[model samples]
Target: MGQTVNLKQRLAYNYLRDGSTKFLCYGGAGGGGKSWLGCEWLMQCCYFLPGTRWFAGRNNLKDSRASISVTFGKVAQWHGFTGYRLTNDGIEFDNGSEIIFLDLTYYPVKDPLYERFGSLEFTGGWIEEGGQVNGLAFSVLQTRIGRHLNDKYGIPGKILITCNPKKNWLYDLFYKPWKEGTLEDGYAFVQALVQDNPFATEDYIETLRNTNDKVTKERLYFGNWEYDDDPAVLCDYDAICDLFTNEHVKPSGVSSGSADLAMKGRDRFVAGHWKGNVCYIKLDQGYSTGKSIETDLKRMMIECSIPRSMMIADSDGLGNYLESYLNGIKEFHGGKQPINPEFDNLKSECGFKLAELINNRQIRVVCTDAQRERIKKELSVLKQDHIDADTRRKGIISKEKMKEILGFSPDYLDMLIMAMYFRIKPVPKRPKAKLGDI
Candidate 1:
């Protein structure tokens, strides 16, 4: 019976007062006293609820030790809850309501841990850094709350989740759902920013305001999902398309070719030719026979007058088929030589890199406004969806769903990514004239 805490403390106290809240989520920007409030609330719960059991979850084991266990230890000691043992892994209170600290990141997959967690007869639970835990893991933890509520306790169990919004699936599962009003019945979402806490220092407020990047600033200071508004076109699309108006194009030098071959029926085959930083895109209308593709590629190379060595093809899926075919062909001036080509996975390695190049103005696109709009539409529709039993069992969301949700085909984007991956090099320069020639 240390000095009674305030309303913030009572929120936790009331939750455990009878152990009835099904889910309580407290989240927002940093330095809003989320952790301190959570620790205090949890202590109140343990103190009032005689035999109730609770758990504290962290994103990882190390984080559990540094953040939850250590913070709760201080709060427990301050309140005169004497008979407790603090170990590297968890904290156990003498009253039988222990906060077993564990990390959700022990397994990237979720299902294997459900059996282990299901065995626990927990009254309730808390997730610190809720943003980092996968949505699937959170669902599994929710199932474990059953142990506390029964004919005897007659009180419904609950979970307390606290986190700062950051990149991850949590934003989709928790924050987005809260915004959309789609969270399950009996769940409550309370948002708190630095301004909400009188304890936050002025200097901290100033630092948050000074962050220049809009995304970082919005997330940390304003707690909004601010999309980047920078223009998608690297070069003025109108200006670049104007350059290609003259049908008789002269080669400044050998051009490089990059292809993104479509293997999935829904995707498209896209190829681009780059001379210096300028790129010309060609959208494949249909999947042609292997021989037809080889012929088309050879014809394009001959027309562009680009040597085989300078060409690079995407080596994923059907692209690999094309690469193998071209490797065996013997039609170039270099005497039966295969095109020295490169390959890349468009999603993981190529896409973001290309986005960076566009943002940096190191790459140029034709910038067809209609095409750009279509691509944007597709990207906007991308969503997390369940794919299979493996994903459903593990609580994992599918990345492929994002692509499908995007309405327009991502073939062109894929091609551009592959092209950018292959074309990355030190900016080419002409050899200097003899020193005396100027």
Candidate 2:
């Protein structure tokens, strides 16, 4: 006999079978029978829709081949499905339907770049561990759907993602919007905890319940959205997430801001808008260039109504060009004397003060949860050391060292430091304009 269908899976498949929704996200926690559902859905689709093509995979090919592919074959056999053979591509049905198993990862791009998918076409596909994939990858995959072997198939191409609770793009793209009742018309999110699944093992459920980490317990068992694990995290997760509610409503006056041009690998150009104390990030994601970022920064200033003079950007050769364009920007160099004597330089001082704001609960950041995670990760990984010669001085980790820890530069957090830099550092008064000529 085939695997039993749970109520949650039944409802989710009904939505997928209707052909009304383009995207279906099912299951929020582990042991929700999600993988079983994936196997059943793909089999049914291939059997019903003749000559259609589909893809299924996770982040690792070895894992997908060793497990996902094997599971599908077993489930198909149990259902009395016949005349299908498994290959490297997928299981090919006699009707010409195929499910291509794959493994997608970031490889070279800091974020997974879907360049491999540029030429491939498909009817629809399922992502096993959806939380592990980035949003841009999904965007790329969506475009390729609805293009192949779908002409005869009455069902419009649909993408299904089975994943546990994660605070990445999935949260903002599906979970958060679903919670707020703002999910788009053609998309659906199905919430499923372990208890909701009929197939969950008693021991497995017990393990999840007994997890020592609060974040792991909330996520793997209950599918909670607000939890993370990071060492030395300056900003509290609750403190940052709470700013979204209507509890704190300050006037929309932006006092100062920051700009981070693409410096090295994995770093995107960013423009941060600071209102009171919260920082809103705007980035140049698609196009990466000096001129492009120059335009993005100027646009942010006008949009936020921040005076051009109050913003600071790193003083590189490109930054000098941007300085000429804005005419109202500060050139930041970390070598400048710190506002605090204990810190070695401007960058270290800025980092110290930013941490103070976060640890003290004095700052609220207006950023997407995913962006907030990036910032939090960077801050938490940064280690502070004490200098030997100067007993009062506190030394910040070098960029080279931080890169070793994080595998990339902390571009966003750097921009945030610049955003908060102006607040604590005293601006020297303009030199006395005693005119020798006037």
Candidate 3:
């Protein structure tokens, strides 16, 4: 096509052609020629590599057709590549190469695991507006690629993702790790801002610049992912992430243990040992019996020098089994009446306090990268439900709703919030620092 792309697009192309990188994340800001780059690259690959199957996907089919499909048509016209017919579901080339379009919307009741994509085969794929799609869909897409014409054509499995700045799985999996300089092997990220695209029209640039909305200006114009304007959100996005790096929040107050118990299923049992505002995860594992959880909790308390009186466990459901085994331990009743009349229940009171501590940079969480990722995802959805209803009591979104947003229950994050119980109703005297022993 002899079309010229900017430097960031070139960098993404290099990553795609290198064969060593399996995932390449391209665009951050809007109008960085994201759709064009994705479309042009997929079309060229379809023409040059015969008999290879590719997949193009987005949050929904309508979005794909309106944006990505139109861009693909423009790319084909620009390159003068003929003999390819667009079907309702995909595009087919005369050379037997095809690109199937897919809608990656997640429906909990209909297709929980995204099994509809399980039987597909593709050499590569491109996910447009990846920020809008769920992580489970992306994961399912990963498994379906590299299954068609890979060995015969000597092409590696590659998935190109183009999205504006968003704090979803892509941010957790790519941008944050990339910023930390610890991006995993076979993953490459190239950040492209709007100003980097020379092909962007001057009128378009001026319109973006003239926008008055702070969130829109920060996200689309400056590519800032940290600014979130959702009215329901209780905590700041950056402050929630800073839980791992808040070094100034020293360990000095009470040394307590908190656990959110789950037994023999997909839910996880997460326990943490806290020293003042800093918490260290003691145990985070799946499928635990009551006896096993009691044993582990006992061991962790002993290891951390946390007394039975200072430890607390969830009193709901299976946690009752754990509380029964351990006498004299405090039981956290999430449904109980709150100490503060302003809140709806114990969980809501604690949730608001947790948000406050996190936003104020008073909480610190020391855990693994995987745990940190889950914590970020969970805390990002800590919203003040029914804020405008004066008759309704102030509360956080229900656990069921949060579970729908996150694929699993927010076990680790719940443990952190449970630890805030001590802060809500403190002991008569704060315990001395025992960091040396822990």
| CA lDDT of each prediction against the hidden true structure | 0.58, 0.75, 0.86
Error of 3 at 32 (Å): 2.0
How do the residues 327-375 of candidate 1 rate in per-residue lDDT, one tens digit apiece?
Answer: 7321111111112222112233344445455445455545466655444
| Colliding residue pairs in candidate 1 | 378-406
Worst 10 residues of 2 by lDDT: 242-251
Q: Is candidate 2 or candidate 3 better by lDDT?
A: 3
**C-alpha lDDT of candidate 2 relative to the true structure:** 0.75
Query: What does candidate 2's lDDT look like per residue over 119-224, in tens digits?
Result: 8899998988887765666778898898886776666889999988865667767887999999998888999889998778999999999999777788889888
Runs off by more than 4 Å, candidate 1: 1-21, 77-89, 108-118, 148-151, 210-216, 225-353, 357-416, 419-426, 429-438
RMSD of 1: 10.9
Mark the 10 consecutive residues where model 3 has the least summed lDDT: 315-324
User: Would you estimate the TM-scores of all the predictions?
Assistant: 0.58, 0.65, 0.76
